[model samples]
Target chain A: MEATVALIAEHFNGALSPTFFELITFANKLKIVTQAKPTIVMLGEEIEEVANKATHFNGFDVIAIEVPGLASYNPETYKAVLKSFLEELKPSFVCLVQTSTGADLAPALSVKLGAACISSVQEISSESGRITFLRSVLGGKAQAVFSAMTDITVVSIQPGCFERADTGACSGNVNVSRRAYRSLRIQDLGVRPGPGCDLLLSEAKVIISAGRGIRQKQNLALLFELAAMFSRSAVGCTRPLSDSGWLNSGSQVGLSGAIVSPDLYVACGISGAQQHIAGMQGSGFVVAINTDHYAPIFNHSDVCVVCDVIEFAPELIKAIAKYRQVT
Target chain B: MRILLCIKEVPETDAPIMLDQASRWIRDNNLHCYRMNRFDECAVEEAVLIKEKFPDSILDVVTVGPKRAEKILLRALGMGVDNATHILSEHTGYLSPFITASWIAKFASDKDYDLILTGVISEDNMQGQTGPMIAELLSMPCATSVIFERISYEERLIYVEREIESGARHCMKILLPALLTVQSGINKPRYPSLSKTLRAKKLRIPVICSDALLKVETRERPELIRHPSKSRQSLILEGTLSEKALELAAILDKKSLIK
Candidate 1:
């Protein structure tokens, strides 16, 4: 049967992240009734932006629904309006690429619409009529596959796993429609920047963070000097450092603060707490250095160093400088 | 104030889960079964605490899942809920979350519940959207990640402590008929007492069929494909303890891993 899958293109200042190429690629792989095209539903101008962006990667045809002024994210309004659209279209399958916010809305919207939801899917496919979804569980230690028996199934694809489609251009029709639901009473609380927030915490390409072993706040400069050498990478601290006021609230990285998945995470003098691990766990590559041989971070890091920061920090920075001069 | 606590039965969080040969879904273990989600147990305990405060108010616990979901309702009743309801159906796999929310919302809509409470997220899916979703369907106000709750009868308002960024806490107040999604570690959910378990066995649970709850519309199927094999690019460190430590530090520093 022909399927109409809606991928709610999340809007960030009327634009979409290029990473959503994973969603487009995965959605294109589904087996549906032949002779009918898969319809892509997007809300707001970002839908058009995504449609335009997706064209650059693949010549896939996407029909977009643009709801004007659909700025910011609202689950209730989205679900309400989407429910009405599903009632009219009655697509055979629906899919969403999992992001922090999309993950929250996927299941609830599916329930309100009476659809089976397959969430956090890293892989998806169908044979005959049955659909299978795959994702990792227990902090990426294991893979779990889920299947749905319903005629209509909804899936939320995980981010970062799929290849982003190369930018390409395609032609698509744009339809502007009003969301069916009444205006939401809830207003978005704008992002509030806190005080003493080091500019680095918000904009760092790389982060070198210290944990409990740093021992003293004054010693932070030792780490800062090295951070300066590394293309102005930012210095951050674990909860203990922030709690002790060794670093400002903005510099704290963990469950309670910024859940940064940076390009590279360098953890120093830190005994990795479980909460701390959750925050930095998303890094592309993790290297942890701590004197305590039993530091928990070693379990989670790509590279682990059991060394005292005081002696190692100075010499390591000096050695790097010397190595750079020779190389 | 009357309260409705929605619970769920999920795969044990710590268990080793495997997929079946179809590569379509989780394999069923003949010997093992599901348990009431740990976080929902907290919601039940919170409702129990409120019932203890206003002994005159009623507490109705409801859950929607397959036949096995009765386990959650039975456990809730044994924990001191005045009544229990299970919206029974075989649609438990991928659709369970949505079906459960719809069933609970339908069950709660006609009833007079001063407050609706559920776990912020189930350990199984861990998506943390059902409470707010149901609240939206019912057109009720909803808030998530609450650690503590207080009810003011005189003011007709409920105040709750919510966890925030940087281990901070904030208090929020909402009128009755509000929904609160609870965070873990809010309060310990108690084990059912032997006497209570025995009494629970005698309580009758009304099972509502899926069609009776709400109308559902099905949509797209996710296309599934084979998973790729991953190669670990690993670097092994070896030497005397101090030497290894220093070498590792040097490597990290050179890589700019240690600032």
Candidate 2:
């Protein structure tokens, strides 16, 4: 039998998450690097639908572990179940999505199996007969390439980094396994809804978003004024502003907040971290304004305006007004 | 209750970082300023809050880094940590999260701490693995991205709210002697007090050499450090502020984005 590369699948609201396909894509890439069979292990209740969908992908073997009591995700149960099962398999690599659950589970799992655990892996390459995983460090300022020395390596693949794995005409085999829920130290209470839906942000055609660069809460008025210039515009911000209580959580745009793909995204004073970029990368046109010329946000932007947002916002607003009146 | 908080010192986020000559790691010479990891500051604040609530609770902060990392430990001490331990690593470079966790777990094993806390992830490395890894090494239950937590002393249990993707919150209950990786924004971290700073300055914190801990084989090694590729048509607009703004307006006008 070929050495196995296990992809841990996560699901939300009964359906396979969109990221699962990304995980499959990641596993497919890993298959090339490690020369191992790609397998997906999904844990949840009523996961048959997800398992069936997983088998449709090419070059993957799906294993659905159904624990009826696990109606929701509990780290302790996840650790307990995966620890015993993975130890027996002793796969060459374990792949997981770099989400909250994966971030929490990968480290603990590595300790259990004594395997190397790498998180937020964005790229992989094989050089000189050794496989290495590339990830960002220093808040995306630098990238670090890591090679695992252990027999078994666990990695959390960064979402939206890889192309989706192509599905072949024929489906692969999927194995269904049932496990009784052993009493766990932690108990899951399901998910509670967060501050309503962000319909304003989602529906806005133009979004002017602020970041720590706004400096103070009062400066947000400038972003709002900029947004008022457009008929369908709305104001938004990065995680720090929301975390600091300067903006409501609903107005926050990032991986943990709303994922908005407005027609025009004006990122003012945002450094363009991966989490913030993931949310707005799908925008039709992006304009980044910041004082620092090397802000990573510029890398993803179509128009990079290297200026202090506080000083530039009013100038841009005046320019827009003058241009509008003349036209 | 006894709580152990793990903090890390990191370069300011905006600090200019460059790859060394060999391209193996970042050059440390350019790092003129360092502070506690932003997430770890939240962890320190959370531990301090817990200590405030349970007056009798003892809080200890530990860090695994070189000599310069002592500054973050002192900051934690100034924030009300009763004790400080520095697991000193003489070498300067990327230390694998595995080694750091191993050293912490070894030191914590005999300390009989009831709770271990750390930031959800380090801002520099952004791995978010050390806390949970320590829990696994200690065979304790663990939670990550914890935004809210409440302890019930009589029941010896902790109720926590973990923030997942898309702003959803997962509420769970864990038994005591557990570990938690605190998410940012859980609380506003208080600045180090002047009095505490004066006292902390006079106190000598115990430092343990990395060699003192059992040598755990490093399982992963970094081969390269470089900047990420630009994924867009980054057309940097040049000229004065007004000229740039006019250029932007023209682009938007061409796209019919502006009326």
Candidate 3:
């Protein structure tokens, strides 16, 4: 029987974000899901904690690797420990979905395990026993396909590629084991927080995005005011604004910048470059306000207003303020 | 000191990238196929700078790609890398970070190198896997997203300055015989000279396969899901530029979108 193992974080806190649940959605769709019960390899206590919340779920088995000391992500250790588990189980297919942490570890794990891996895969299908994989390339400008001869395949699906699974009352069998880090040769000095605002890029929902529009640094006040409408949203910008040092580098969104998939994406004065589009392509709704009708952003916008933001700024603010007062 | 800098050959991003109708991928015809990713180029540039700083050190470029990738290696050689090793694998088209790492780690294991370097992430996958993954396979240390730095051979340590959130920069120090993944802005990679390119053409390379290093772990066939093109009716936003602006303001205000 072809057994499939899904490598996921254990903390099943029903509160798993779209990125976390994306793994579950993909795993359930596997052709092997019906024939062979899928098994999930959970790392650390948080993932295990989440798994416990989801033990009643159907469609797969849940195994937790008790690496208590692994409070933070270390690529070397995750690869070593995951590789060891993989070697022991030798599942037909092992899918490692990418989170910020998994993206770091999946490649190293693939190398060590001598496995065929597909990174940032959008979809997978098997026919006549051969599996074909597909992924986006060149900052989402193109997609590529690849096939492997080995029976075991490692893949890290991109976030937002699949419909999220409902976590209510789902359960599966659980297996717990302790991990030995003998395969890992590296040691961590410690986890140093990344530089800047420390804004959680993955969790942002409402975003006020800027581009070449605002014209100058002082013009960012307009974006800040827009962002103030939603408690969950933050301000973002295209590469130009971030590159020119006019805005916080952390808030930049594009292929070279942070990938943001907010519920509401407000692109202001931003000429939508392809590279920039790749980052926010997954946003739920995009509203672009630009003066130029030929701006490429107008082509992709859900709602577009062709007018000068500079001329409309004060009145828009006043109107919203009035609305807020009335409400 | 000996260093193995891993490079990849990717389609130039500046060109108009369009997929062939038959296959669901970009048609790489007349499009320029040369130039490593921006970040990998930065990594190679860092290696060259390191070599210049320490004339006694030797820098070797190694890449796990098809025959076409050798063009990049030769380009690196012409730009001043001593020599290169191409672990030739025909099936590299499906070479994920894991498989690429396996091929690279197996090759690196054979060579006596004091350090390994790669781009923080390739513009292609943007996953940034090889450096850290190879470190795990070889059981070595790794640091990703390094923007600027200098390496010390004597102390076997790397001093790095990286940009992070809020325009903040952090200085980090990591011990070597370690792996380093650099971002594109670190250093602009140089152009290879004609003479160096000629000399590099004569250089010999070694080709290896993943099968020789480890057993077949698995071959996953990922499906290519095309993002359907969405055609939106564009309302050419027009009017007495100022009046149009007011009209747009009224619309935006009605939506409660912008304040």
Candidate 4:
């Protein structure tokens, strides 16, 4: 039997998530490492349209499991359905997006199948007939390369790490199967919109983002003042600031919040954790001002200014004002 | 109600960490400080809140790590956990999530706890696996990234709201005897009170060596640990604060970003 690499598709509100395409990229990498046939497994209600869309990708066999009552994601239903099907298929590898759902499911699923489970895998390589997975550890200060010992390996691929795979002109066949899901213990009440729905951050041309290094909640005024200097600028923040209730949820940027690609992104006091970096890395011009010279955020920036954002913000504004008058 | 909160000791978030010789793991000797993981702090607070509500509830906090990990357990105790257990692994290097989960599950199974709690993920490994894996090992329902939870003792269920992508919340209900990996911001963890700290110092926490648990071999082994290569070549600004600011402003002006 040919080894199979299963790419678990993530969908919500009747649309495939961007992570689905990223999972395809992961599948492509696994093909290079294991020479396995790629298979896409999608679980949802009335997912035939998304399943058909997935089949357009070349060299992938699609399995669409429709559980009638599961309109939204229920971990219990997902685990129950995938467990029975994957046990029979016995895929050599299973790939999931490194999100809340994937992180929760992968390890538990591995326990059921007795497979090796690795989370937040950023890179994969095969050397001398052995495959190794690379992941960030110690808050992205270091990377760890891991090798699996079990027959089947389950991995959660980090988002924004791999480029989306191109389907080109070729397509593949999809097999749609309906499964009955009965969860007496858990029920999905659908998704509820969170508070703070400001669209300013997403629409702004320039974003001045703050992080924990901003020191105190009162210091946020410095960021706001700097942002007001520009015509179409907005104040944004990392998860910590928002978690502290200093900013609304809408102004937050990271894996669990808005992904903005502004014309210019000025990170003030931001340490540039992976989650925050994933949200703003696509900005056209990136500048990071931080007190810590070794902050990881500098690695992703175009210009790095090592200074306390509190002191530097006022000086930066003065410099900009002086430069404008001179020009 | 008996609640088991799983916590781990990790290097302080801002601690300077370096790759060890042979490039396989971090150099522990150089790390000057350690504390309860920030995410696990939320879990400990949540369990404490539940204990506060029940008043009769027993909150048992457990950690798996070397001797240095006992400090975090005591810290959790100082935050109001009723009891503490430490699974002494003795080694500081990378311990696979599977082995950790297996050890935790073995310790938790016979206790018949009403609920198990853990952090969404650790600051060190950031795997976010142990809670759900322990649940699976014990055949219990599990929830991850739970931002809010309300326990209904009468109904024997817990209603939880899990944070998903794009700030969306997925509300669900799970039966008791389940596991929840809590996300940060659920609650503000309190500082250790003087009286509680004094009391915790006198409490004797039983240390169960991991060797006493069912022997589970790690299925995944870390082969290397190194600094991540930067994708962009960032030009670090040089000189004093104002000089750097002026240089940055010039660059921004040249790009027509600031006018």
Stretches of candidate 2 above 4 Å error? B21-23
Residue A211 alpha-carbon offset, candidate 2, angstroms = 0.4
Clashes per model (N, Cα, C within 3 A): 20, 1, 36, 0
lDDT of 1 by residue, A1-327 (tens): 355666565545556654467776776676332223455666653455555654444555555555555554544456667777776877766777665456546766666566677766766655575556776543342355567666566677766556765435464554545553444443333323333345777577678898767777778989898787676488988865775577876888876677787777779887664456667877878777776554556666777666677666776676566545655
- Candidate 1 RMSD to the correct structure: 8.0
Candidate 2, CAPRI quality class derived from DockQ: medium
Candidate lDDT (C-alpha), each? 0.66, 0.87, 0.66, 0.87
> Among all windows of ten consecutive residues in candidate 1 chain A, which has the lowest summed lDDT?
A186-195
Candidate 3 lDDT tens digits, A284-312: 76778876654556666776777667666
Candidate 1 TM-score, true structure as reference: 0.62
Candidate 2, B1-259: lDDT as tens digits: 9999999988777756777647377666535578999999999999999988999999999998889899999999998889999999876677789889999999999999899999999888888989999999998999899999999988999999999887789998999989999998899999999999889999999999989787977888888888877878989989998899888888888897786
lDDT of 4 at A91: 95
TM-score of chain A by itself in each prediction: 0.66, 0.95, 0.68, 0.95
Determine the iRMS, in angstroms, of model 1. Answer: 7.3
